[model samples]
Target: MLLRLLLLICAPLCEPTELFLKPSPSQTIEGNSMTLTCEIQPRLQTSKAQLQFCFFKDNGALKSGWNSSPELRILAMWTKDSGSYWCEAKTAKATTTIRSRRLWIQVQRVPVSDVSLETQPPGGHVTEGKKLVLVCSVAKGTGNITFLWYKGAMGLKLGTKTKHALTAEFEILTARENDTEQYYCAANNGFGLSLSGLVSITVRIPVSRPVLTLRTTGAQAVVGDMVELHCEAQRGSPPVLYQFYLKDVTLGSSWASSTGGASFNLSLTAERSGNYSCEASNGLEAQHSEAVPLIITVPTENRRDLLTSGVIEGLLGILGPTTFVLLFCYCLKRKIGRRSARESLRSTSSPLPQDSTYLNSPTPVPLQPVYGNVNTLSGDDIYSLVYSTQLEQESPAEPPRTLSKDKVSLPIYSKLKKITVIDMDYDDAV
Candidate 1:
């Protein structure tokens, strides 16, 4: 009987007096639901036994009154819902209350959103050998975000950054021409991906000394031939302007919007033979090329042709009129000689009809006095005038009976055949 009484006393102590609170899905998400339950260590004696349960978080009650239900439902937990939580269990007739140990609940946040990419300098331009910085930012996000930077549509990965801050930076020690391209960034917090807009970058390089080349069809450059001036910069940006020069005089200018070389064509002349050069610029420092000498040559065949033509033309111009004048003078002299011969023939053949009788007499006869032209004298012609006078013997007594006069005149001959026939004075008897 004493053993039975001891068992009865231990039986009351064995009844469940502890309250336990358990949560389904111990790890919670921001938009998910969770359930918390309050229970005894063992099963309740009967369903009719009146029991009450209530929930508390961070030492604050979740509800004003306890509920008959053992389970508490928390729908849509947020980041702020993360804290310490516990539950209390009590009987309607008993004055004793049981409490469970405190449990910590943590709710995860959403992924990143509104991601953007920017640069240290406002514009997208960057000079060579200068520093370049890329900044990626998130407008709204929680937790550690992984940021990745990409270049161009081919998605060439530049860099990656993981941090809890709103923004991240990636820097290039020295920018170069190869670094010029389109860039973007992406942010991910293990939930969803966010992409930023593209940012264009251009790296400017100073123009290098250009190379000038002269192109021609033949081996040697000649006058009146077309020559091409090709100017190229091995390293420079586009939109470069190339200028051609001859002895410091500007020939022309060419603009290359997307190429490294520009060309200018010229029809060469003798005066164009000089030192040729070129310059290249892209809105930065300009560079000049070395001067190249160009000498024009004349072909041997062409020179010979020109000389031959010039000599022939000059002879024709000078001697043509002179030959014509000489021929005219010769013809005039021959005509004058023929006229003189005709006049001489007429004078000798035609005319001495009046002297026919005198010509028949053997002795010379004096004719009436006649004057003849002195210009008609020939080698056998005679030209003269003579006078004859006679005196009587009575002249001593009478003082000369008026001296009897007898006058005779003879023709004066330029060439004398004989001189005995002609006398100037005559006596009474001779």
Candidate 2:
């Protein structure tokens, strides 16, 4: 019974517990060496044990096994070397022990050398005879590289170099309309060939020699007349914008050819009677035509009417003051003449005049008709003269004789009574 108890304790103590590998989670590149070691727990002297190292993939397939060694060595590892492995040992008591741990291997790969190409001033209708440059660059890779340029299907070998960057320049001298096509590039580093994106190029042809033609809607332009002046380039490409000018000032503008030429018109005015010109441009460049003088004449009859009206207005403005002065002077002269005539009438009709001593005095006088009659005065006329003389003496400067007698001879006074009735209608008319 004691022996059986000893055997049971010994067997339980001697059995293997767990197995593991050193560098437990290791990794390595392809075409490289890797080492896997098996280790047992409880400080077992594993050198005395018969060891077996076995490897398997996670998919339950056996890779390889060794029955005599605890260590596994992999030389020049490849993708197929990547698997889980374990170690087993057989002791002198014939008991077998297995490792619960697993081993893994990793492989590295080289980078690919692929490149792309691009061009500036990218697409169609580039200016003709202009220099164009293309750039080629590697999109992926880590080695010496060279670039090759190609036009359509033809390959143009550029220089080879260790640098991955390269540029190719092509000058199109005197480019024709037909020199346009698709272009591409390739990058190579002896390992492989990589192609870039395709680019299309078109060389633009400049417009032909422009010819400006001037045309008018009418035979002659008159002032204030609506006229159309057409400036056209007959041979230019279509859809060109044009601007019209008169004497350096812009009148208006119009658009025509999309590809090349245009026409602009203007309505004529008196101020537009100078050299007229037009300019055509198509976003790229502009050109101006020679000046064409357009004369706008005014008719002689209309000019004469304007001059006559000006003269009449000027005359009226100058004559207004002179006429006012003349009228005032004439009114004053009529008043003075009437006053003198009244004075003469009063003196001649005075009393004591015919055979009096006053007639023998030194003052010689001529006898004139008084009141239109040579008369010896009646008593009433004598009294009237004496009374007027008295009144004139009372007011010396403003005597009654100073009153105008001509006013009394006016048509207004003809209805009044007169001392002598003379048929003097003919004389008054004269």
Candidate 3:
């Protein structure tokens, strides 16, 4: 049984087949060393196979190792030293030497340059509510590098990226004032590390919408009174500039410092009416306050200085109707006097005019009639003139009667009752 076990173990070593070279480390950093050893694939643990080892780099640069030593060491590796390295093993019992399979070694370059961080907004300063992008890049390096971004002195890791590319980016959505701090980035390859200079981020906050208040003891603004416009913003980073506006016209401006607000003053006038507003700015775009509607009126002390509009309007109401009635009565009296004179002339000699149109015409009285007994006629003659018509073409009716006292009585028109305005209190007597 022992002889059988020996044959099983030694039988593989009796015939040699293939040899391969293996390196201690397949990948190494720059300026480091690695070792390659040549071995037989099928070997007995106790069998003696004498071999001469030779190491070749990229099929050139031969290195001879004695049978005593089958290993070769390459020191101070560089970029040029990266290639296939293999070994040849020649056994003392074999007639020809056999070459081993190739093995490859990689030499990596460490970064020896600085890193820089640039902001997207060009200047590191950024406006609030805007996106902030930090770009980290290396000036010179070769290898897979890891980039890390730190915020402030706390070295808080904002983000990290590992890639073969020389540049990486980190982003912050909706930047705030608290985000303003010293920022930096680092590039780390396996061999060495590089840190960039400090980059500062400044977050600028714009002024808020201003609230405007009018400072006055009374509800209204009087002419020549100094009225103050107080403008305030709930939140902002200042020195902030403030302006007051009346109907889009600028009154004046004021300034506030360090998270505060501002104000403006104006001398009130009648022309200063309609819409009023205020504006707030912090070297940024201007923000305007909501408009407040204002209507200014004139102030008068006594009734004589100029009667109050209410009292003047009441006087006109009473006088207007009275004047109208008096004019109506005067016109009626003139019409009656003319008719009386015309009738008196017809009864004495000249007959009344036959043309109905002539009696109703609006033309002025003839110049001759003004002197011809117009004043001498009595009032009774006017009444007969309206009803008089000699029955030249009368229907079957009562014949015309002679003028009598009762038939010619004067017709009296009821005069518009004289409108009398009394000064009485219409309000409650109390």
**Best candidate, TM-score:** 3
Would you list the C-alpha lDDT of every candidate in the order shown? Answer: 0.76, 0.55, 0.70
Give me candidate 2's TM-score against the actual structure.
0.41
Write the residue-wise lDDT of candidate 1 on 307-392 in tens digits: 79889889989988998999999999978866675465446532221221112234434433333323333343432323333222
**Where in model 2 is the C-alpha error above 4 Å?**
1-115, 120-126, 142-146, 150-182, 190-193, 200-210, 223-227, 232-239, 297-430
TM-score of 1: 0.43
- Supply candidate 2's per-residue lDDT for 341: 52
Best by lDDT: 1
Query: What is candidate 3's local distance difference test score?
Result: 0.70
1-430 per-residue lDDT for model 2 (tens digits): 9999877646643765677766422666555677767666764544544345554456563445545566666666655556665555545454555645665555543343555666556654566666565666765543345666777757555334345333334334454545577767776655667787777877654444345555555677776566565655543334567788777898888887454455565565555778877876655566788887778876788668768977988998999889999999999997887666555556663233221112223343433322333233333232121111111122335323333335223211122222433321111111
TM-score for each of the candidates: 0.43, 0.41, 0.48
lDDT of 1: 0.76
TM-score of 3: 0.48
Q: What tens-digit string does per-residue lDDT give for candidate 3 at 319-356? A: 88998999999999988977765665556642232311
